[model samples]
Target: MTLSLFSQFSSPSLLGIPLIIAALTLPWLLLSLPSGRWLNSRMTTLHEWFIARFTNQLFLPLSIKGHKWAPLFASLMLFLFSLNMLGLLPYTFTPTTQLSLNLAIAIPLWLATVLIGLRNQPTHTFGHFLPEGTPTLLIPVLIIIENISLIIRPIALGVRLTANLTAGHLLIHLVSSAVFTLLPSMTSIAVLTAILLFLLTLLEVAVAMIQAYVFVLLLSLYLQENC
Candidate 1:
């Protein structure tokens, strides 16, 4: 009875107030806080282990200046990972599917990195616009190109996250609708389609995780450049 499939992305509300903050905070409820005891629960231990390993591997290639970004990046990875996984559940919404929210997260972080580079190492950052070469004629063109590309990073980051999640959700919904429509008339084909839907759902689960990782990974790379 829905008029538009895109309605699924609409934020839910209560008493005319949007539930955006609640949706964003839902992931934190799943995490267990560390205690003062000598032993921690399995999930807590695993969480800590993954955080340590992820932070270590991600920032290893960067300079010491970049090491300061580990806490921010690690927290972001976990937050994105949780929201993405939770969205796979029935009746749940993915905030990352909203381009506005994604852009809000991406632009400030990307701009901060660029600003840091300019503030801390202005000459080196300026060097990125043009490499050492004898092409005097192409300097303006190359500088313009590099500057545009630099400006596009945050937009790309937001769009990538939004597009990937939106596509996967749409595909899943389409296949599910097809399965329902075919069920009563053509049982055998519907069964096969249902199986395919199951596999696709599994694939989507992987996509959710990968997209989150890629989001955080690109941010780390940007931080690496600036730091």
Candidate 2:
């Protein structure tokens, strides 16, 4: 049998990408309203000291006039990371495995970085896109490369996430399916594959958190550089 790249997408609609994202997000949204008060209260705890310091540095542009966007951004990261982990489950769709979904997220992240940079230092924001210490003679060449790289970041981010999840899921599915098919009489083989898949699921959870952290970390660094 020929392997399909998107065989997972052909599954039942309830487990598809659109529903998966909604399923993961609805609870967070519903609970967040009530949780906001409690969260706000707890925000002053000692555990939040380092977080506040980091937030101050990253949101310096937004925090200039006693404004702070870290909570909203933090919420977004939590939602995305949870959604990503959901994809690692058996018979469940990972919305992030789809390029479109990842692109939707990555594009906004890139734009947010640019917007914050511009808000902080409009003149330098655009200038930073051009290499800092490059000679004027090579300014044109540097601009072309820098602009291309800047535009490519979101695309690359989307592809990196989607491809990893998609490939990993497909590999697991193939192995599980093969064991089921080839050793129909041997339950042990199928069981082994299932155990392996479970281990991979744990790994996927770690990867999801790491990917979310990486995205936000890079965004903060980008803001720092532009600022």
Candidate 3:
């Protein structure tokens, strides 16, 4: 039973081709591109408004140099948000639940911020390793600790996203399983469990959206530090 619960995280495939590829690419294909018209559809109008607001909030704290990243970060956030929300549908696989996928997205972006800092401000970047007013005895230790923390950022980002989605999916699976089991012999208990399952599903939906936002927000914060 425990193994079966976790099996949902495995990549699904058909005819030897992994469906995870589709899961990753389908969101982009489904999104509508803006049409060149005097008046846009309501959905397109709302979509544009959301993107504009998100870009404004995301870059508000960033300096002029960092503003250039608005498009990349906005697209990333939308991609992640779409993946997370789509995964909630029944019989669909969520690529983000896989640590490898999350790490693939995280490491390059994190490294880009680090490289930007190194390229543009070497002294400031290196200075992050050791703070001011440190005693000589602890300087080496602090540098090592800071280096370790810096290296862990991408790993933390990946693990955080993977773990949250995985846990929520697992919980929903277990509870839904319990609901079916109880329905045979305890109608009242089964109905109550079903209600609980509905609430949990809603919570998972919120978690999905928030985790995507957090992942992008952290990246923006990293860019801010570098730029």
User: Per-model C-alpha lDDT, please?
Assistant: 0.90, 0.67, 0.94
Q: Which stretches of candidate 3 lie over 4 Å from their true place?
A: none
The model with the greatest TM-score is 3
Shift of residue 37 alpha carbon in model 1, Å: 0.9
Give the C-alpha miss distance for residue 118 in model 3, angstroms. 0.7
What TM-score number comes out for model 2? 0.72
> Root-mean-square deviation of each candidate, in angstroms?
1.4, 5.0, 0.8
Query: Each prediction's TM-score against the native?
Result: 0.96, 0.72, 0.98
Task: Summing lDDT over every window of 10 consecutive residues in candidate 3, give the lowest-scoring window.
Answer: 41-50
Tens digit of per-residue lDDT, candidate 2, span 1-227 = 44465667543355444465465565365332324454554434532664566566557664343234577656656666767766665656677777887788878877877877778678887886675788998999888888898899889888887777776777777776766775677778778877887787677677777776666666655545554
Ranking by lDDT: 3, 1, 2
lDDT of 3: 0.94
Worst 10 residues of 1 by lDDT: 1-10
- Pairs of colliding residues, candidate 2: none
Q: Going through the candidates in order, what is the number of backbone clashes in each?
A: 0, 0, 0
lDDT of 1 by residue, 168-202 (tens): 98889999999999999999999999999999999
Q: Report the candidate with higher lDDT, 2 versus 3.
A: 3
Candidate No. with top lDDT: 3
